[model samples]
Structures are given as structure tokens and as C-alpha cells.
Target: MASPGKLDTRGSDFARLARQITDAGLLDRRPFYYAIRMTIMAAVYLGGWALFIWLGDSWLQLLVAVALAVVFAQLGFLAHDLGHRQVFRTRRPSDIAGLIIGNLGIGLGWGWWTTKHNRHHANPNHEDHDPDVSPAVIVWSEDQVARSNGLPRFVAKYQAYWFFPLLTLEAWHLHIASVKALFKPEAKRRGPELTMLVTHFVLYFGLVFTILPVGKALLFLIVHQGLFGIYLGSTFAPNHKGMPILTAEDKLDFLRKQVLTSRNVRGGLFTDVALGQLNYQIEHHLFPNMPAPNLRRAQPIVERYCAEIGVDYLQTGLVESYGQALRHLHEVGAALRRPLPIQGA
Candidate 1:
């Protein structure tokens, strides 16, 4: 019944919990389930592409493009699971599958994404250390917003309102980031990833351009990218956005850190399928390699343990989760508006 703040994850309490969860067999890999899911998603993606091909220059092709984007996003979800080794036992096979899904299926560099995501898992919401919290167009904390200037400062002022709108460009942003990472010398053995990513773009553009005129192809690209961005961003943004952020100087045990820095979205099968069970963000952070299906089962145990240890466990509806993130952004930005106090006072 001790507070998580006072408990060390390396101590017996956490070890016992982990053992219990593992002994419960909730951490079992579900390779067959993921294999079937990926097969179906791939089929759907190709089907959507076929529809776009058949529809040609008609506006109806836009629908197929959107559908294709959705499939791509789902494939992205699978790639994420593969990266965590949730669907596979061996790291190499998981990496290979993630590369195929992320690079070829969605035009993302798997190595780049894994590197970034592993950092996030290791140090969630650490102002300086966590890449996820690093300022892009929006400042994440009061100190960050205070230090901002020019366009970023202006963007931070209205970030809460602009957040969703800005996310429409995330798909494009991710694609560009991936492409850039492929060229980075430190990205590590990226030859296969680069090839797959280039192949994705070539096939993606070649098919669209072949099926439609230049103008229609552009529109299709916009719609596809926009929808894909929203889908992907919406799933990921809620996981840790509004939760308590850590600083590089503030150290905590892994159990407390993950629990306090994460938020869970409440939903059933639909949410699980859409978010790849990342809605169980706390548990997912605690047990990254656990299969998506097993996350739900792990949730109750995690919640119970957190409750017993007096950790602040957070779960909210999808809309509420977004609102929490927005509120956090707005509050952080508010610091920029506050006038400095006189030194004499």
C-alpha cells in the first residue's frame, strides 16, 4: 500500500507484480493473430488501390484513396507492435516485419521510428531527453514556451486550438522525417530500409499518377496524407500528452515513471483495433513486448497494482483525453503571456 513514488520498480514489489503477470500468461505472443491481421490489411490496401485504379479521374476515387490511407495507418499500428516484438519472439524477425510494414507499406523508416520510440519508452515526457516532448511547432512545457521565439512562439499561443488541424500534416511530416533519417549516417544499416521506403514512394506515386491526371493525383495525395495523419496522430497523441511530464534531472523508478506519465483511453474492441491497444498506454509502457490483445487483460492487473501502491492511474474517454492534452498545451502556453516580475519585488 505504499505510494509508487516511494517504491522502487527494481524492488520485490514490482518484481512480484511482473512475475504474477507473466505467470498469468498474459504476456504470450500472438504471432498467428498478427499474421492474419496483417494479411487482411494488406489485402484491403491492395483492394483500395485497385478501386482507385478502376475509378480513374472520378471524384469517387477519393473515397478509395482515403480507404487506402486508413489501411496504411492500420499497417502502421501493426508495424509498431512488431517493433515492440509483441507479435514475434525473435528481434530480427520482428525488425524485418516492421521494416516491411513501415517502410514498404506506409513509407516510414522502421529503424528511425524504433530509435525514436525506444527513447520515448525509456524516458517518457522528459523535457530535454524525450524526443516526443521536444518542440516541433508547439512547445510542450512552460519553460519551452517561454524560450520560444518568432513563428514557434506565435504557434504556441494558439497550439491548443491548432493542434488537431496541425496534425493533418503529421503524415507528411512523418514521411519527410523518415526520408531524412534514411540519409543520416548514424541511423545504422539503413540500406534495406532506404530501399523499401523509396519503393513505397515510387509505387505510391506511380499508381496514383498512372490512374489519375496530375490535378486529381495531387488532390488524392492531399486527402490521403491528411486523413492518414489524423488517424495516426489521434491514436498516439492521447497516450502521454496530458500526463505529468518529467525533467532530465528528476529520476523515478520505471513503474512510477511509466504510470504517472501515461494516460489510458477507455474503450472496447473497436478502440483496441484502431489504437492497436495503445489506449492501454500505461500497461503498454510497462510491458512493451506484450501482445496488443493481451494489453486489455494486463490492464486490470496493472490498475489494481497501481491503486494498491497509490499511483495516479489515469483513464478517460477519447474526447476527454484530447481535451486533457489541449488543456495542458494551453496552460503551458499561458506562461508566455505572463509578464515578468520586477527584480526589486
Candidate 2:
């Protein structure tokens, strides 16, 4: 029952809770479930785009385009899973799948995405690594929530308005240079990372210009891209919010930090429908190789781990989760100018 701030608590309490959770055996990562989920997302992306194209210059084309945007946002969720390595056994397979599906589905640069995502896991609460830790999405820490000395912080906090307007494309372009560096010679060697990016731009551009009418292309972009961004931003922000941040002094391992810092949202219908097994974040963090669907099954085991650690495994409904996310936005806005401590993943 001790709060996360309690340092005097013995490790035995945590050890016992961990044993109890593991003994319960509720956390199981299922590969097959993740596979099916990925397949579905791919299908939705393809189907939505195709439908928008087929609709041609009609209003339906615009409607479908909007849907296409939404689909892209949803694809971000799937990409998040693959990035976490929760969808497959091997990194190559997961990376390749993420490239093929994510590129086509969300116009994401797979190589860059994987690198950033890994960094995110490595520095969950660290400002330098996790650019996604913005007021536009996740809530900020107390320092992060404090006001800045100058315009950059002011612009960042106020710029959130433009976040939704440009949300779909912002992630890629906003962090372009940083992401592009990720595909440099050393990084690019990893399955020719940026190679997939060229292919993605080519394919989508070709489809938009040649295969589909100009009107249809425009519509598809609106629907699918919008949907994708909204969903992507929403789904990812909640993972770290409402949980305590860990620092270098914590002396915890990767798995322990994941349990203590990352949390599952009882996503209910959206858990399976939108995120596949990501709803079981604690288990996914504990065993990245486990498939998404299997993560749900691992819940009981995760519960035990929480108990042993004397840390309450956290979950809140979706509505409440977003509200918390919004709070994080304010907190993060405040922390812009403050110094953040280094921490392990």
C-alpha cells in the first residue's frame, strides 16, 4: 500500500508481490493474437484507401478519405505494437512487417520509427529521448508542467492548438531531422531502414496521383490520415501518464520499470478492437516477445507482480484516461524549461 515515493520499503515486499503475480500465471503473450490483429489493421488500411479511391470524385470519396485518415491513425497503434516487438519473435520480422504494413498503412518511416520507439522504451520519462512526451498528448511532470523562461516553451505550450490540425503529418515532419539521422549509414544497415521509406512515398504518391482521381486522393488523405493521427496520439499518450516516473537512482531493471512506469488501461471494447493486446501493457513490457492477445491472459500474473512490488497495478477507463492525458499535457507544458534527471528504461 506504500506510495511510489516510499523509499524505505524493503525489496522483499516487491519480491513477494512479484512472485504472487507470476505464480498466478495471468500474463501470457500470444503471438497468434498479435498476428491476427496486425492482419486486421492492414486490411482496414487497404480497404479504407481502396474505398476512397473507388468512390472517385463523389462526396463519398471525401467521406472515405476522412476514414482513410482515421485508418492511418489506427495504423500508428499497430506500428506501436510492432515497435514494442510484441507482434513477433524476431526483430527483423517485426521490423520488416512494420515497414511493409506501417509504410503502406501510415506513411511512417519504419526504420526511423523502430529506432525512436526503442529509445522511448529505453528512456520512458526522459525528455531528450521521448519527444512524444508533449502537452499535445501526454501529461507532463511537475517540472515539465512549469512555465519556461522564454518563447520556445511558450510556443510549445500554445502550439498545441495546431497539434490536431497538423497531427497526422506532424509526427514525421516535425521530427524529420532527428528521424532522418536515425537512417544514416550506421543505422540504415539495419534491414536498409530508409529503403522502405522511399517505397512508401512512391507507392502512396503514385496511388494518389495516378490510380485515384485528384479529388479522391484528397478525400482519402483527409479521412484516413486524420483517423490515424487522432487514434495514434490518443492510444500512445496514456501508456506513461498517471504513473510515477523512475530516475537513475531507482536501480530497477528493464522489466521492473516497465511494470512500475508503464500501465494498462482497461480499454474494454477498444482494447481488442483498436490496440489488440496493447491493453495489457504491463505484461507486454515484461515480455516483449509475447503476442498482443496473450498479454490479456497475463493480467493475473501482472497483478501479482504489482502486489509483490507493493505498487498498485494501474488501470482506468478510456474517458478518464484521456482526461489524465490532458492533465499530463499541462504538466509537461510546465516542465519544458526544467532540468530532467536521467533514468533507465
Candidate 3:
């Protein structure tokens, strides 16, 4: 066991790296970048809906649904940046923008998501602390496999195969979770969030139903929401899924905790744009407030510093990262997949 003094020294490792990062001006805000990005995203979003309205009572609208799903996921990425205060210095402006991009634009509750995401950043892959890894329709660890029953248990044995299929419902899960979070006693901005969510639903469904026949309208909803969920889930799945899973017993320093549990996906401009720069998961975790544009600049500095300190930094190609995550999911479910022994044997 490490002594308290040793732990303090280990913790200071992050502070030293933080100082280097601060000195590099990588932490500075990029207002112009955000301004341009938001403009483009807004244009794409509105244009998608306009195209939908233009193509009345046609199956070609499904293509528009696919396009809008990508736009919605992009909006979700913007909301994530806003929630992290990467776009705005103060909580007020950040929350305001977050609510618009998240609640009003994408039908996600900004407050609920921020609270949950903050917790995720604080403890990335901790079994007991990270809600992302908590037992749900899929179990992340053997301990969770033991505790899981009913749907979770049934799914655990084939979770890797089920992963992508289940992601189809991720958008609906998030929407339901957002609403449920509002009813919790500790929920903040409940009234405003509820209003925006309701308004979003009304505007969204009204426009769809008003523009198309009932069958087409329902199909549009399915394609749009399903692809939205898949895009969003795929964006997030690579970050930490295959990385180390921490527990109460693992007392890692801040630097190691974040780096060890996160994986980076390597790509050029297209990947950066698609993943909303979250492909640089390690840098993002280290400097949550750093603007999205600055993450690329900060990456090499972080990687070099980690190398200097002998902390293993993991980066892989986009497809490989997904493969690793799926393999991890399969490995976690190994126990559940074993054949049961006969009663007498």
C-alpha cells in the first residue's frame, strides 16, 4: 500500500504537467472557432428540416433523416463542449448555450447531462462511481454480471454482438433518462429544462406529422432517432470502453487515473470533425475546460510528458479502437457465457 506522502507526491505529477500545459497557452479559449462552427451547424440543422419539408410524402426523406441524425449528433457534441465550459468561461453562458443546443435543439436536458458527465470526468472508469460503466442493459464487469438479473443477465452473454443493435435505442434511453432526472429531488433547472424538452417534442412531432403521412412520419422518426443514437454512441464508445476499469481498491493518481482509463483514436481532419475532437480523449479528460480546437495542439505535449513519466499512453486507429472496445465487452461477459454444470455433476 502506498503511504499518504507517496500519494501526495504522485498527485503532484498532474500539477507539474498542468503547469506545462498552461504555459503553452493551450488552455486559451477559441471563441472564433466556436462561432464559425456553431454557425455551420445551425445552418445544416435548419437546412435539413427545410429539405424534409420540401420532399413531401416521399421515401427520399429517409435520406434526410440520416443526414439530420448526423447533424443532431454534432449538436450533441456542441452541447458537450458547452457543458464542460470549454466554449464559455462562466457557468451562466455555458448553461444557456448548453440548454439551447441540448434541450431545445436536440431534446436532451442540459442540466441532467452536465451533472452526469461531470461525474464521468471525475471518475472515468470507476466501477462504483462511473454511471457509464454501471450495470444496465449491459454489464461492464464481472461483479456487475453477478448482480445483474433478468434482461441484463440475458443480454450479458451476447453483449458484444448486441452492442451496436442496442445503440439504436440509445437516443430514446437518453431522452427518457433526461426526463426522469428532472423529477429527481436534486435536479436543477427542472422547470426550464422540462419546458424546453416539451417544446422540442411538440415542434419536432408536429412538423413531422404535419409534413408527411402518418406511416412516413413514423418511419422518419425511427430512422432519425435510431441513426442519431448510433452516431452518438459510436462517438463515445471508443474513449474508455476498452481501457482499464478502476475500483475502490485502485488508488491511482489523477494523471494516471485519467490517462490509463482513456484511449485516443488516431485520424486526420475528418475523424476530428466527426468525433467532435473527442478522439483526443486523454487530453480532453486532463483539460476539460480547454477549447475543442486546442485539444489537437495539446495532444503531443501531453503524450511527451506522459512518456517522460513512463505512463503508457494508448492511441489506435478508429476501427481498431471500436474492435478493442467490443473485445473488452466480450471478455467481461465471459463468465456468463460458460456452460452451466449438471445438477449432480
CA RMSD, predictions in order: 3.1, 7.3, 3.4
Q: Give the TM-score of each candidate.
A: 0.93, 0.74, 0.96
Kindly indicate the candidate among 1 and 3 with the higher lDDT.
3
How many clashing pairs does model 3 include?
0
Output the lDDT of residue 141, model 2.
Answer: 55
Ranking by lDDT, best first?
3, 1, 2
For residues 96-193, write the lDDT of model 1, one tens digit per residue: 88888899888988889998999999999999889998887878888888788887899898789889899889999999999898787788757888
For model 3, residues 1-345, the per-residue Cα lDDT tens digits are 334343324438899888888999998899999999999999999999899889988999999999999999999999999988898899899988899989999999889988999999999999988999988898888888888999999999999999999999999999999999999999988899999999999999999999999999999999999999999999999999988889999999899999999999999999999999999999999999999999999999889878777789999999999999999889988998889998997
Q: Give each model's clash number.
A: 0, 49, 0
lDDT of each: 0.87, 0.61, 0.92
Measured by C-alpha RMSD in angstroms, how accurate is candidate 3?
3.4
- lDDT digits (tens) for residues 83-185 of candidate 2: 7765665688876777776654456666666676676666676544555554443235554445344544554464434345555655456235434665577
Highest TM-score model number: 3
Rank all candidate structures by their TM-score, best first, as comma-separated numbers: 3, 1, 2
Candidates 2 and 3 compared: the better one by lDDT is: 3
Off by over 4 Å in 2: 1-35, 38-42, 128-131, 134-139, 142-152, 156-179, 182-185, 190-192, 211-220, 247-256, 331-345
